[model samples]
Target: MKPFLTGHEELIHDIKYDFYGKHLATVSSDQHIKVFDLDSTTSSWILNDSWKAHDSSILRVSWAHPEFSSSKILASCSFDRTVKIWQEQPDELHGSGRRWSKLVTLAIESYAPIYDVVFAPNHLGLKLGCVGSDGIFRIYESVEPSDLSQWALTSEIPILNSSLPAKSLQSSFAIEWCPSKFTTTEKFIVVALDQGFIYGTKPGGGKDDLQNSPRQQSPLQQQLEQQPQSQQESRYIKLGNLPEHNGLIRSVSWAPSMGRNYHLIATACKDGYVRIFKAIETAKGDLKIEILAKLNDHKSEVWRVNWNMTGTILSSAGDDGNLRLWKCNYLNEWKCMSVINTSNRSDNRGIEVEPK
Candidate 1:
């Protein structure tokens, strides 16, 4: 495949691929969103569309499931405290090229700058999850899937359960949905603020009335429930937390189960460490979390951590300007399989080793 230089004037904040990997969406601090399509003939990327999406620097961009609409749909959040949706439409005026049009803008609840926005798994319907400097986890769902613009705020829950002010400008937040379609009963998303916490939707994901039904609670949730009455109550249930992350979390990614019984999540932190957590559901519906591996190979603040499609291999990047690939062996141990240093332009080859 051939590479083309990006036209973004400022630093790119996020890049995401569509569900089928046919299109790529990138957002930048220049307040623009660019979509690139794969050219099947030349195996190269072609700039499909670009537009000024936000008033301030765009922080994140997410693509909805391909099946959600006949045309491509994208969701973006920015420092302007708004989440905007765009849809690809036939450009009647141009006649040849398709163009993107703003579908809707969501900015009612978020008082602070939005940091991250993610679309839920296709199985969960057309929904978007957002988090920002306000420390609120907001869920918006399109009740009428065919009409993408018709969306309503379904839930607004605090990221932290304690009374301590959750709002902070120094901290960043991220959210990732559970991608397992086999998980039929419970639907949830993991949010990363000071640490990683899993929050599950109630019986009905929409604006359902608060139900005090009996349910099993993890030990951590039980402790959170014992807090003072002044603490704000949330509709979403707290599933569990990724403990021992002493510093602020930069990113969190959930791995595709690929038929695995348990779930795997990777976390990037400001403390110069990368952590992987294994979560399993018990018979009582409580989540049991354990640290699978902790790596400090970056020796600097970790920026991002993501898992491969099959959940077999994991990749991490940090402030050290290096990208590392990690994999687990049959013995249930993880090791760094490869490293690519970006500092030296001449020697850019990746040093790779066998997984086992």
Candidate 2:
């Protein structure tokens, strides 16, 4: 932890960490993906582990399965309309000093440019989800789609809930599915608007409109239908309509796993507001978003907000060319834990957007 890890060609769009805490990865708008590791004994020193992962600017990258860390799988999506899966090359690192071999790449064909990617809870190791610029959520089944039978398609979870306040294509920046398919009854998704509106869905998520489709009785539709009546109580339940940032909602990430009774969220807004929203439990249909803390230290629009693999803290980045970490206080509020100011003397994050 030498205050910063060196090496990246350009601005970073998102970061994902393995559950094991030893390996971490980042996707950059520069069209590259870098995987890094921290020294076990000295945690602050960041190692540079990188590969040219995509043809165009990368929009998202996520850990495929850290529950199985050695054979590391990282799924990355980009403006090139491709989703790629990368596994660690064995005996790849030359020395103990922080270098690894090129990634063994496999492409998951996508119809459109993918902006976000996530792995579904593992029933089989192959289930994964991806969302594109068109706001269509497509779940790809094959590790390699050319193997069509093994690479079957899952239903697409369309983003525009015809009934809710939909953010037009010109405004959306990211889509995130809950990490755990925790409940057997429903699914959860967080839609981040470029204009700062963050909307949420509960268990039988988006059932109000997701059930009806041109193809009657799709697998997902059946999943929606078969949910026990009791579980459908808040199906498509609209949580808080949080005003995230002033410019665009760059990114949104749900906390990893915590066996708790409530939900917590962290969002990075264009207005440079790194916000934390806590779910207040109740019997009503409205999901309450209590802004537990507001961070205004950055000088530019914040591009992303992600809770660490463990959910105890969150990391955010922006046009400002800096990375900041925030931690929760005993009062359930968030405060700045650490800050990496700039890669060089030239980068600075600053903006004048009005607060949302």
Top-TM-score candidate index: 1
Best by lDDT: 1
Encode model 2's per-residue lDDT on 194-300: one tens digit a residue: 43233334534443233332123223434544656445433344455555456556667677657755567777777788877776545654456676787877877
Question: After superposing candidate 1, which stretches have Cα over 4 Å from the reference?
Answer: 92-98, 161-169, 190-192, 202-235, 347-356
Stretches of model 2 off by over 4 angstroms after superposition:
3-12, 28-52, 68-70, 89-111, 121-126, 142-149, 161-172, 180-186, 195-245, 256-259, 281-286, 308-312, 318-340, 343-356
Cα RMSD of predicted structure 2: 8.5
Which residue pairs clash in candidate 1?
none
Q: For each candidate, what TM-score against the reference?
A: 0.85, 0.64
Ten contiguous residues with the weakest lDDT in model 1:
210-219
Report every candidate's CA lDDT.
0.78, 0.60
| lDDT tens digits, residue span 223-253, model 1 | 3346443332344578788899878888888
